[model samples]
Target: MKKTVLVFGLLILALLLMFQFSKYAVISGDLKVELIVASIAIVFFFIGVYINKKTLQKPNTPIEEISHKRIKELDISNREYEVLQKIAEGLSNKEIAQSLFLSESTIKTHVSNLLVKLDAKRRTQAVKKAKSFQIL
Candidate 1:
């Protein structure tokens, strides 16, 4: 934190020197307008970064933790666990079906069961929950 502040302070000092040097020269009116626009853009960019930094914290929901624990307690079958692994690798139902030589409908059924077991609304969420539980 201190390092960031020091670096920012140094940057401001450098800009001050640049402005001072520009004063000794014949500055055009258009140049001043350009400088104003550039400064506004820079300030807005930093403000956006600051606001985003404050809001970008990872949310640790109790439901998510409990869901993981419950999933861990579950004795998922080997086939279901394989489907979970493929899902974790970002495979779609049809893709997983193709890879595992099963029908897409069968894959859908397996995924549905996995979602119910994991207490997730989607396959991606199920995969994440499985991972959190160290089950896949």
Candidate 2:
């Protein structure tokens, strides 16, 4: 955070200096108004490009492969796995039922089974265990 603040502070200071220099040049008639404006615009364009490059950079992370063998070993059925994925997405039982076109009670049963298979006490813990097992 401190490093970001410092970098931004320096950029602002440089921009202020450039503006002051342009103002002085205009007042003294040492530079043409059009030339000054063009130079400032060019500087601003480069600054925008720099900021975009810095802020829009995505981290390179390896994609994790789901373990089908682990899922089979855990005895989680396809429908139960689907319900588990929905639960991992933070969906409610009613929402999961609606999305899957199943009854809410059925969704609840799948969740219960997932909890037992994952040996988890809660939905979040079940999801965490599933990820740790590479089944999610």
Candidate 3:
């Protein structure tokens, strides 16, 4: 925070000095008005470019690979995994059933089986465990 304040303070001071120099040059007829305006515009353009490069660049994070072996070890079926993914997306059992074209009872059964297989007491816990195992 202190560094940011110091940098901004320096920038403001530099801009003030430039403006004062431009004013003196204009009064003394040493520099053209168009030249002073162009110089200020160029400085602002560089400042904008620097800010964009610093704040808008994306971080280079590698994607995590899913653990198919862990899924197999947990004996989670494809359909159950689909249901688990839907649950992780904050979907309710009815919504999962609708999306998967399965009955609500079937969805409930899959959820219960997932709870037992993942040794989780709740849906959130199951999702958390699945993420920890890198199987989701």
For all the candidates, what are their Cα RMSDs to the real structure?
9.4, 1.7, 3.0
* lDDT for 78 (candidate 2): 99
Q: How many residue pairs clash in each candidate?
A: 0, 0, 0
Residue 3, model 3: lDDT of 73
Clashing pairs in 3: none
Best by TM-score: 2
What C-alpha lDDT values do all the predictions have? Answer: 0.75, 0.94, 0.94
lDDT, candidate 3, 18-80, per-residue tens: 899999999999999999989988997898798779779999998789999999999999999
Global fold similarity of model 3 (TM-score): 0.72
Q: In candidate 1, what are the lDDT values of residues 1-136, reduced to their tens digit? A: 8977876787678677656655644265445656665765686588669757866977887443334445446856678878888998999888999999999999888888888888999887887777777665
- For model 1, the stretches where C-alpha displacement exceeds 4 angstroms are 1-72
Candidate 2, residues 23-42: lDDT per residue as tens digits? 99999999998998899889
Local error of candidate 3 at residue 20 (angstroms): 4.4
Question: What TM-score, to 2 decimals, does candidate 2 have?
Answer: 0.87
